[model samples]
Target: MVIIIFHFFLIYSAAAVGLAPPSTYLDGCQPMSCKRGAPSVRFPFQLKGRQNESCGSPGFNLSCNNKNQTVLELPKSVKLLVKRIDYVKQMIQVYAEDGCVQRQLPNLTLSSSPFEFMSDYYSFDSTYKNFSLFKCAGEGWSHYGSYYTIGCLSREPGSYVKYTSSDYPNTDLFHCSRTMDLREVPEGLISDESNNLYFNWSRPECGDCEARHQGCRRNDTKPSGFECFVIPIKHMGTRTKLMISGISIGSFFLALSLSVVLYMHHLHKKEKDAQGKIEQFLEDYKALKPSRYSYADIKRITFDFKEKLGQGGYGTVFKGTLSNDVSVAVKLLNNFKGNGEEFINEVSSMGRIHHVNVTRLVGFCADGYHRALVYEYLPNESLEKFIFGDKGENHFLGWEKLHEIALGIAKGIEYLHQGCEQRILHFDIKPHNILLDQHFNPKISDFGLAKLCSKEQSAVSMTAARGTMGYIAPEVLSRNFGNVSYKSDVYSFGMMLLEMVGGRKNIDVKVEHMSQVYFPEWVYNRLDKGEALGMSIENEEHDKIAKKLTIVGLWCIQWYPVDRPSMKSVVQMLEGEVEHLTVPPNPFASKEEMRAKLPINRELPTISE
Candidate 1:
């Protein structure tokens, strides 16, 4: 029979006590086989068929529950449900099943196994099945245990802790309990079985571990299956057990005390850390609060949403009157989407970049889930309405006023992209994004995708493409499309310019010849042919402004991101001669129609893109 000793070494090891041995294994068991149907007890563990003894160390011990099947009290702290234990490589595979993803994220427990394979003895077969080391979200997150699976797998945090079975009924894998993660093994040295664990030990199995060998255990620790130098147990010293029991009680009490002290110390440190985090959070979140407004205030302002002003991707806009009888446009931010970020973006940038041509963010509302923004009403609405709408708002503005509107818009955008301390790239810059005030002056608005750049950086990486499809620059969709830079905004503005001249969406796909006419291509043909620059406005000067805008806009919409002009140059061109305009190469013609926009050479491993 093999006697295994169970030893637990944690602060709470006393409460989780195991029966230590007074002597090593003394009798009655048969030799075990690797294929034995009895039960597989791998390295760092062993089991006596009948006789019971402690295993390896004072703490690395485990025992079969009443069934002599289910392994529990593993490392004395966690319960391990053993399936098949492999001895060739030291590991015990256990199952960790949680129902859903969100559920797994929070309370999922760690792998309940101890008895790690020594670094010198075993190394995980990493390349075998695509199983790599476990990674955490970051410093605040925890690493679950390393897993030896047929393939790579994702596991919850709290499953990996370097220290184990240092205490009774548990191990040294202490967790940060409802706090920071505590599951990082200094490195990925220790790996647990995905489902079936295996272990590698010194040359001989327990049978050969006789006279000179020690420390080899199967299920329990030293006294039971511990392999060590053989010493003769000569006499059975008997005795009075009373004094010994009292000493044992005193030791147990002492162990219990040490655990409490350590636990308290951990909590104190966490409290101090939390205090610092709160202060930092308050400072950052101070200016991010959504604007506040009352439903009654909304009713009075929007005139009960009466004017029937307009509807957009977000919500309805109504011209209204405030208590001071101030005329304002109340945008009842939609209930379905969270666009309050636009409110924040506008307010933050507007406060920093003050310009008369820029629409000011007056105030906002974040009531329950309801959000809204209040701004001084621009009775003229937007350029898109008059220029593109079926209605006759276009008849009201003659050529010179239209030219002024165009100049004002160009100045506002140029200021955002260059004049401000931070070069703000207004990603969404189209007719709809441009609002006009009472004096027929234009103010750039809607900066939901604005990217802030220092004087140092003028370019940035783009992810999934954004902005209106017709207005999106090629570089935004893929690097092969071109290098992404502030010029992408130039592309959108160009599309808007053509629309202002054509009196509708540039690429209509509606009028057959003009439908697929591809605005950029059509604009170039008209300018090169020099037949009135091909567009006619009711007012003659409107024709020149329209022609000038069309040529400059075509130049801005060039295919390569680099081929586009800076907003400063755009303002210059708008103010400059039509003859000075250099024609920009058109990259959107057959190339876009023929091939996939992105390069095929870059093979992204594992990423679905």
Candidate 2:
């Protein structure tokens, strides 16, 4: 029995070692669509006949219908044809097969599935618009302007379903009876004419993989989890697989003992090669300006990380003191498995930045897997503490100081945009990233999400949205708004500026009334109506400062990047008096209305000197 077990182990090892590599196993699961012009299916979405079950996440299976359309069947047997898939945004657009989305909307249920309606995924207060659906029997319903008739659902002649923005429509006037209520529908999803419905998924998050142009697969350790890896370019053909299988079977016993030894040696060589590559990169990077430190040096400078200042998604920051009595903040990067893009971005961008308003990179540590960044410590901490903290007078930096800080931040951003050899766009520009010195001077910090492009380049290509959700620009989330550029940073700055004025987050669910849920829109309405801002104002001067900042922020957050002002112009607007500034067009209007009003041929404003 012992001899037989040993022989079986040898045979298994030989067969495994001689078979084709794992890359060929995925060849059958490559991206495919039901028909031409249909959305291609890959990870997180698999076609039943075309791809293996392991290729897609649970509850994400798609199938081809009789008409060769990609069909997504919901829990209630409701089927919709897939129109498009935005892997970067994790969104899928679908429509009914019969060109009537409303007919299927009543039966569409996203529960028990990995997907959610787009409105539910965003959870923005503005996206919540409840409408009442009424079944009416009348030919004169067209005269009622407030209600919209569902033309497709009205196929039964006299009786048809009509929907209105009001919660309770005058049923008697139209001889109608309220049938159902559609709650929390987004404006984009309200119109039936488009016949398209949008959905978003959050499970088995593969957006990061898609953004990096990598392939994602289920982890062997778990059934539902996923891991990203480099995709091999070539796949073994059927003939190659057949030949390899034949050879393995023919020489199984002859090569059995040697296979195990060779496999162990191969594993050792791969690890050594990876280490060698990292060492080579570090050696070449020594020529850069920032001094490279070892892990031991990092421990000494940080005193074994005795005092942790803050922690974020990327890393943890500790307070440290240099040998020369210079106080510094040392950031120990997280155990990231990426290609060191974040570390390279921070060092390359901040090393070239010399402005007083931008943070200076003192040095960095890259010993094996451990990485750390050292910077001059700001005693006052971040601007977020002062603005969003208690309402005490001492904590409030006052309107004048706040204005000065805003100008300083603008100058720093302008320096990043135009002062450097290559234009640097800070993808994250919230109040939390704005550090304050002992004198309360604002300095922009954190370059992990920064991107560099030529100053002459009008736009920068981005695969995924970066920065905090509330501060991210519309275009970053969806390219339909416009190409991403320095204007993206301006939009984030605008959100932060508005937060400064509102003394709270831009999206505050704890507000007293629903009107104030979206603070920016509320601010716009007040300014448009020429009403007082209602914030605790001391006098006339303070009111003007508040109004000026509000208007400027509104201008910075225009829907299209082309409509936003440059950082240089923003700095001038901040330096000038409030009286000289004019209120920009309302940016909170509906998307369709705003697009129709704005010119299609409008050129992006040139960066002012």
Candidate 3:
């Protein structure tokens, strides 16, 4: 069946290559600019009024303002004036129209756009340094020459705003009070002069063409892709054209035949190796007593895979029913690229856990190449739907229910880390993995990235970092923070707790104000100032519950793993009164120190589960 599909794909490719002729419009798409000295926009960057859509890549559209200045609008409505574009280097120099890019730094996010900060692209580091913003009384602080004053945020009443990159600034010396921390701007890009930000694009890659002084255009064979072509000369001889055509046709067939043979051989070898590993794993764990079903049984239970509960990188989950009339969620492992390691991990960790807060593994199917795991169905679904859906959904849960849910999740994580004989570390602990029952009780699910170690073991060995981004602990990404231990799970839980309090994602780029972009940091600053948490607080009791959760979350997310509390301590803190809870030290304080530890050009191993 696989070979037949491959043959069809090969035939389709051949037809596509034959049908797609070279585009004749390249000569018409000449470079244009808003005015003299303005950056010339060409291929991959189209001038909106002057060029057609086919002339440039998607999301690379540029426009000219009334002042005849080249303008580029990034995601979230950030507009910058284009100063210069280096096509060979694939970099763009842009600055805010107001001449102060620092004013827009908080809301400036490039993740959704095709461009990336030049410093980030070169350094291979996504971490940002925290710049402490201070509002000082009186404007005659020229003695503190190291600090730069933000003219836009400064006031006329003998007060001005100054910022320093130092994590611990001497506030008394400058006679200033810390207002907030700016983390979006990189240390290398921040300057007192004109805020010229350099950004480079990796897509519509034409560096090779630019180096050779050739033309690049969209690949006609694949519209979503790109291709480089040689510059055409006027009036080619017929003999030269015939010779070139013959050579290209001959080479195309030769390469296609070779690729087909090699691909088939590679697929056969991979399937044999994967099957062998599965068989060995099953033999090793056969003594464990979960009912193993055949492929036919899985089909019948899922009613021919009709209803899909969810789909992820690993596989698709279907809603199913057992012979005993019990409902179950069957996850069919369709994209099994690993050597049965994730299958082994899930079964090994979940088969032994029986806590009320943990999801139950009822049965599994390992028939031939088909593999699936059946879990008890939770009618209320995941906690993510309720918390992040809408204002109405959040109101339904209320502050009290959110507090209770937080405690239940903490207890569940505690059980995974300690209740069982072997310490089970759930590498992924986001809100999506936490399922809620009809009674709204939380159950931890998804053990594909779980690790098992003896309770006596202080840390576990890891070949690669696991878990979803934004929730992964510092140590898991780099060992400079600490060892990969149960504390990693604690860090992830802390992030989720903060997310629950804000009723939004922890790293929200769509926030209206720059200061609120990083929700956790913003929450910490608000709490530190002894101000109202800006959340939906109807009364003082709800306020107390929110503060307690926030404090516990802050404590759990401390920069160093040693500073974070254990799951056991986390549960106690959650259960304790808000008055007894104390706010943790700023987690963003040591970002500069930790950023130095990240090695450049270090390739993280691919996690294939």
Estimated TM-score per prediction? 0.46, 0.51, 0.50
Reference-based lDDT, residue 487, model 3: 89
Residue by residue across 198-235, what tens digits does model 2's lDDT show? 78887788899999988877776866588887787467
- Candidate 1: which stretches are off by over 4 Å? 1-296, 303-306, 389-396, 512-516, 537-544, 587-609
TM-score of 3: 0.50
The lDDT values for all models are 0.58, 0.82, 0.81
Give candidates' CA RMSD values in order: 29.7, 35.0, 35.2
Clashes of 1: 63
Model 3 scores a C-alpha lDDT of: 0.81
Q: Across residues 503-530, which tens digit of lDDT does each residue of candidate 1 receive?
A: 7787777655853367666767766776
User: What number of backbone clashes does candidate 3 have, counting pairs of residues 3 or more apart or in separate chains?
Assistant: 0
Residue 428 in candidate 3 has what lDDT? 97
- Model 2, poorest ten-residue lDDT window? 119-128
Q: Model 2 misses residue 271 by how many Å?
A: 56
Clashing pairs in 3: none
Q: What's the residue-level lDDT of 178 in candidate 1?
A: 18
Query: What tens digits encode model 3's per-residue C-alpha lDDT throughout 1-609?
Result: 446445655665565445444434445776689998888787789899998888888878799999999998886678888988888888888878877777766665666678877653244334457787778888644436568777767756889888887666455544778887766556655553547677888888888888998777766586648777776644546875665566556655655676677778889999999999999889756634466789899999999999999998789999999888999999998645787777778888999888789998887888878889989999888999988966554435888888989999999999998899988999999999999998899999999899888787768878899999999998899876767788889999999999999989998898899999999999999999998889889998999999999999999998777778999999999898989988887888767865564455323222222
